[model samples]
Target: MERGKGSPGKAPRVRAILAGGLVLGVGAAITLAAWNDSDFAQGTFTAGSFNLQGSTNGTTFTENPVGSPATLGFTTNPANLSPGDVVTAPFAVRLDGASTYDATVTLSTEASTGSLAGLTYELTQSEDFGCAETVTETLVTAGQTLGSTPASVTFDLAQGAGTDPGAPVNLCFRVTAGAVVQAQTGSTTWEFAAQSQ
Candidate 1:
């Protein structure tokens, strides 16, 4: 019987591979354990009731101890505000408290007689206080329906690590559309909400 040549170091090679794989697995587990944190998802402030349209916009929206500060505001009437007979309002959103959590605020409009192509939004925040962040819309839809208005907008915030514990932070916004020749019009409600990851 002829003896076949065998790789004498085959067993050692196999052992080395297995050892490397085990080390890598343990290292991965350790890395995961070190970085896994649930606190990052925890919210420091309880969420307050969201008012899509409050006393802000054309007027001032003061903050009450029980209510969250107004981030957006505006007014709308169903009969006169919309291109047709639809109702919509102005809007804003709050970037509030510790900017740790993220949020998206929106404003939408009622059905219109035409398209809202030239409309845009501008957001304003107090330069002295809370950096009152304001954002304006870039466009507003005209052909859309009233009850389905998308005067909506979203925001993502990263509050610096050292913001105040609980201070009144306000983010205001305004809207203007159309040209000097065209009748710039849109109707919808303003909304502000905070969502965290």
Candidate 2:
């Protein structure tokens, strides 16, 4: 028996048809697939400003930076001291106009010089700029020794609305000289540290 030449040609044609059908099937599957898209998100951040200022006369507020402190204008002469003498001074503090958050002000003694023996002090919150005899609130207890800072003497300051400065907190410091107080020059420096809340 002789093999027919037509059989070989038919097999090649069948293979070519099978291969073309496979390619078309693959192309149709890709075209029928679902369409897709994507989205993204982002954010921006910034920091707010904060500042604290103080005033001795309550009219002109400024930042009393370290090394150059504001001198308190005592009602009595601090240079000339006498027994049973009491001197008082007024101070005011507030958050500056640019501040964006409220804060807490803590009072502490930063430095002391000369002889502070036989001297005591008292601190109070006053209703007005003048350290009046009537006390609105007691911040530091009476009879605290000179050059000594009381623990937990703190006050709160609110942030102002818009560009205006916050309301001022008036403070009064009263110092007394005892009978044993000597004729020596002495000075005490107090610090008002503010923390934003």
Top lDDT hit? 2
Q: How would you encode candidate 2's per-residue C-alpha lDDT over 1-197 as one tens digit per residue?
A: 23686677689889999999999999998988866788999999988877989899989999998698889999999778788989999999999999999999999999999988788999999767869746788999989998988798999999899999999899988999885455687889999999999
TM-score of every model? Answer: 0.30, 0.87
Query: Pairing residues by index, what is the TM-score of model 2?
Result: 0.87
Model 2 backbone overlap count: 0
**What value does the lDDT take at residue 195 in candidate 1?**
53
Worst lDDT run of 10 residues, candidate 2, spans 1-10
Q: Measure candidate 1: CA RMSD.
A: 17.8
- Candidate 1 residue-wise lDDT, 109-190, digit = tens: 3234444444444444442222233333233334333334344455443333355322223343334433312444443333
